[model samples]
Target: MNTDFLVIGASITGINVARELKQRFPDTTVVVIDKESGCARHSSGRNSGLLDAGFSWSPDTLKARFCKQGNQQLSDYCERNGIPLNRCGELVIARDGDELSDLDEIQRRAEGNGVKLEPVTARQAREIEPRARVHEQALFFPSSASVDPAAVMRQMEQDARDAGVRFYYETSFLRKAGDEFVTTLGTVQAGYVVNCAGLYADQIAQQFGFAGNYRLLPLKHNYLESSEVPGAFRTHVTAAADLSGSYPGTQIFLGVDGKARLGPAVKPALWREQYHGAEGFHPFEMSSVVTTGIGQMFQGGGEICRACLQRFTGSTHSRLITAGSRLVEGIRASDYRDWARPEIQPQLVNTETHRMVSDFIVEGDGKSMHLLNTVSPVFTCGLPLASHICDQVAAATGR
Candidate 1:
């Protein structure tokens, strides 16, 4: 097979990249290949579906640069395409006086990022959501929303197809030879390649001589579905314990159908696709992850160690219920016994510096471009990020 542009993954990033390339160079042929049978067979379909308001990142990061714009663009797309969307809003609450500073910092970031966040008192927060438990004050973002990820994924796939993009499913890229790529189906030649593989991005990039000092540190995010009625909680309520957006401290998110779900107890995984027990297990990948985690624990001033401890302590059913109880006026542990579909975040860590890469990363040359670290908020930042990447492609190839 031959094409002008080839995209490695068919998820949101890869599909949008192919669409953007076709839009930029209308006469050129664009193709997308994925190991899965269809789009969103992985993380893109199994996420929490929260459209983040772009307040958790510093203004200097790429996440901050694209998130606000992406959120707006996605919301608009949903409205125009008849996709189900819930304008549920978000509440960032402080447990006590010590954490009030975190709310202020988030507000500062919101201001710098051109996002709207309002400060509300305890009484005012109750008016917004009767179940909320606030310390003294909280920040309310009316622009935060939710959508059905699977629905959005289906729509995006159709849109890409409508735009003259070809998709090759169940075809995995095996290796590269000279100027052609060896795939499970066969070899192919391309003018340019874009790597947006979620879990195995680093491994694929290494074949092209990129992502040398980075490796994916997969984290399992688990959620619990509340058995109560749909409108149990009016909006999303999250604890302000961590502001790095690395650990989504105890949160209750309302789905597009108005059902409330609590969770995302973040814990490190032993392997890349270790979503459940003994499922998708790879021994070699487990060994590599363990070795890298041990190195990070010792060299990064025990930051990873502390994070692991927190997650381990809070992941249990009883412990998770306790944490959730503090965020809302919840009553029983029996209401949240059912666990939702688990998702994994393929976060990147700097192997040399032994620190987590907090921002988005892109490493490429004239022949190919690799999107290495697209962690949380990438779903919300997908549209704008794709346009930005296509801009780089234009500059590199003079298209």
Candidate 2:
């Protein structure tokens, strides 16, 4: 198949790119390729689904811009397409009495990003959430909301097909065969190629002399839900904790069917695509073995959940030793249950700096662009990010 625009990876970014590309060049042929059977089967499918308020990233970066705009665009898309969305705002609590300054910093960053935020007293925070414990103050992001990430992508695939865009599923990109790409299915030529394959994007772009010193530092997170906290969180609530200590800051969301979900114990991962005991799965293998740190083991999914629980903050790390029965005043230890499925987030580690890349990185000219980092809140910012990429492509292709 010969296509004018070839998009690699059917994650939200690639799907949106295909949609925008087709919209820009109605007469041109656009082809989107993915190795999976359908879209959002990987990172897009396995995520917390919490819409970002753009208060985390620096205001002077692409993340702040796209995330802020994408929040609204995606919400509108969901509303128009009949997809589910929860506009229940967010409450950013302090990790401790000392973390109020961090909340203040986030508020300042939100202001710089043009995101609306207001500080609420602890009394008000309790009024908003009767069960959750909070500090003396919390930042309220009115724009923060939640959406069904997988559902959004499913609708996108259908809409893209209806828009005359070609989709090649169950087809994997192998290598560049002269003017075409050699895939598991067959060889195909494209005028321009875009790499948005979240996990393996580095390998793909490196073949084209892109992604200089970037490597994926896959971070794994497990969802721990309270067995009986249903309808507890009226609005999504998170902590204004520092980035250190592998702090998987807690978040209480009014989840599907009115159940309350919590905790995403974030930890660096050894495997990018496979989780221990996750249905006896492995992406590609040569029977290699690697050991975890002291007092750590990954036998399977259940073991992974157990290991993550060790680092998980559960309900109250801030008040673990500081508070008493109030931490579990209405919540019980047995109420803490983890979801069977876990999510893996893509984090690009800059080998040059030995630090994680905080902002989104795009490489290559408009003709061939690669989305280097598609992490948290990306689904929330998909629409604006796609438009930005489309603009770059238009200028590069002189379309």
Collision count for each candidate, in order: 0, 3
| lDDT by candidate, in order shown | 0.87, 0.71
Q: State the lDDT of candidate 1 residue by residue for 37-111, as single tens digits.
A: 999898787787889999888898889999999899999999999999999999989878888887788888889
Off by over 4 Å in 1: 244-246
lDDT of 1: 0.87
Q: Give candidate 2 misplaced runs (Cα > 4 Å).
A: 243-248, 278-329
lDDT winner: 1
Question: Which is the leading candidate under TM-score?
Answer: 1
* Candidate 2 residue-pair clash tally: 3
**Model 2 Cα lDDT, one tens digit per residue, 1-399:** 788999998988898889889988999999999998988888787676767877777767787888888887877888999988787787777756788887787787778888988888988877766654677888778777777788888998888888888888999999986677899988888899988898778778888789877666566666666676446567776666642123335556655345666565566556677555554344442121132221223322334335345554342433232222232136554556455366777776565554556677788785488888777767777788878888878887888
RMSD of every candidate to native, in Å, equals 1.3, 5.5
- Where does the lowest 10-residue lDDT sum fall in candidate 2? 286-295
